[model samples]
Target: MTDAERIARVQLARTKGVGPLTYSRFLETYGSGLAALEAFPERVRASGRGELKLYPADKVRREFDETDHIGARIILSGDEDYPELLGHLSPAPPVITVWGNTDLLKKPCVALVGARNASAAAMRIAHDMAHDLGNGGYTVVSGLARGVDTASHNGSLSTGTVAVIAGGIDNIYPAQNEKLRDQIKDTGLVVSESPFGHEPRANDFPRRNRLITGLSLGVVVIEAAQRSGSLISARTALEQGREVMAVPGSPLDNRTRGSNGLIRSGAILVENAEQVIEAIAPAAPSQASLFEMPDDDLDDETLEFSEEDRARIIQALSPTATTIADISLATGIPSRKCAILLVELELEGIAGSLPGGLVRRQN
Candidate 1:
């Protein structure tokens, strides 16, 4: 928690290829951010990845300073105030930059996500539901996009709301949401995992969606297309063991297909805020128990990988997702060794990890 430790943690997290999962593992193995950074180069070399690229110390320090100047604060993963529900993510963000009402994060939250080009009826439903939920003592959470997200936040601003942005805490996307963003920053909460001044890219939405669902006790889908980011958030909620709820819509509307599909697939079917509250009420005690961070106590005993072993593991992977267990069986590598090799491959940009412990070739 000291200044030096904060800087080191920021550097390690911002380093290319060291994602949330890898960051947590490094912290567990090295016991400190400074120790992890000092050992990273050697670890990369031992993994057959040659030298690793690290973020510059000066750049991280500058980011920290700018965050302070903007009146926002950086909350590290292990901090006392970090949202406990979010901290339970398998690869929870190592750091989140916040602009306001960090205390709202401790309250029970339900995510309301849906199509950005949503119908008027859907938007009204979302708005009213948000207001009702807020009045009922639940903080509403959503991505700060257009349509449903905007309506959700607007409805709950007077009570409590949380906006998880895809860009940096200060970088407002959709340009139109700038004022709304500022309003939330003043009365509600604005959060982002991205560092200062980083503009959101196409790939950042899914990452941001994960945080939306991760910070909540449950996720409710208002109106989503067959393939949409709202569905992605619902999927993440399911993966995180959070409840998923969906509002049914007319079968004629394409926007309702994804949400309808969710209900068919066992998500709770909800119409009003009362149903949503009823669904999550009984889950409160169990949800509290589920917030325990995943244990990272894999045996730290080093295991060397031969060139052939690495090649075989790579050959076993494809663009199609495969579970780590399947990869281990296919390549005759121990599961733990396969995991280490996969992390190395991820750092090298040769592989990527998907939800549900799945892995796929980056190319």
Candidate 2:
């Protein structure tokens, strides 16, 4: 990829309505960032999404400038240095900004996430788990929050740790961890989807949680409320087919309630790092070369649909499943055209086909 392509990928990622899935779909349809950048205006026009606004190339070039100014670089998902585990995730970040040792991503990783306001014991558990995991040649992944998140990063600081911050690498929120954040950049790696200087917001936290699990082979939730961010990360791990492990905390402590609940819901109940390492040992050696992308054949230009066919299909699409007959009738398009369009959408990772002749957009 050229510098121009990198700038275009970043621009599309920063664009309105051009999410990871949409950007990827556009790339597939256009075959290159240059082509995608050129085709986007008309693509949105046909889809009736006039509000779609891609970040101007000049502005995104400035973003690259800012990244370089901060001693960071953008890692495209298709790039060799991009985390392979994360690259395979559904609608993964199109591009991630990074600081420090990207080499640490090669080691096996385990995520430790928990309540931001966890108890003393929870902090200790995170610390111990991270320390031992680091000693076992594993990189500990976490958000650098106040309680357990902070403890996890702190403990693994000496060995190896990857801080997947909710905000940009330069904009350290929860200001108290600013120093620790600096230490992480020096020792390990810091990553974020947001451009540099962008502050962390509540909305961005969920996306950040997914990256925590995306980087790890397993996620360990120490202390979380029944519906906390930690559980969200753990759930993402389950979604990504990564192992879900949680420490059994006391039911009485509200902070531990979510992890305990997860334990009951079939997550691995682990007390020490030995359990974590032993559980992962069998698969680790075999999958050591995981950073390599599996599909060398996947290239753009695979998405080709006539405007009439695309319109007919979109008109038929709804939140609920629709049969062939229903789709044909609703779109006023032929059966063959509808089927072909749906296949194209599915291949582009835009939609999923369900059983009994149904289709719906994937989240």
The lDDT leader among the candidates is 1
Residue 155's lDDT within candidate 1 is: 92
Cα lDDT computed for each candidate against the true fold: 0.86, 0.77
State the displacement of the C-alpha of residue 173, model 2, in Å, after optimal TM-score superposition.
1.2
Residue pairs in collision within model 1: none
Choose the strongest candidate by TM-score. 1
TM-score computed on alpha carbons, candidate 1: 0.86
lDDT of 1 by residue, 44-106 (tens): 876667767888999988998999998999989998988888776666789899999988987
TM per candidate comes to: 0.86, 0.84
Candidate 1 has its poorest 10 consecutive residues by lDDT at 285-294
Which parts of model 1 are misplaced by more than 4 Å? 285-342, 349-352, 355-363
**How would you encode candidate 2's per-residue C-alpha lDDT over 35-110 as one tens digit per residue?**
8788777666655556657788888888888998979988887898888777766556788989989888889899
Q: Give candidate 2's TM-score.
A: 0.84
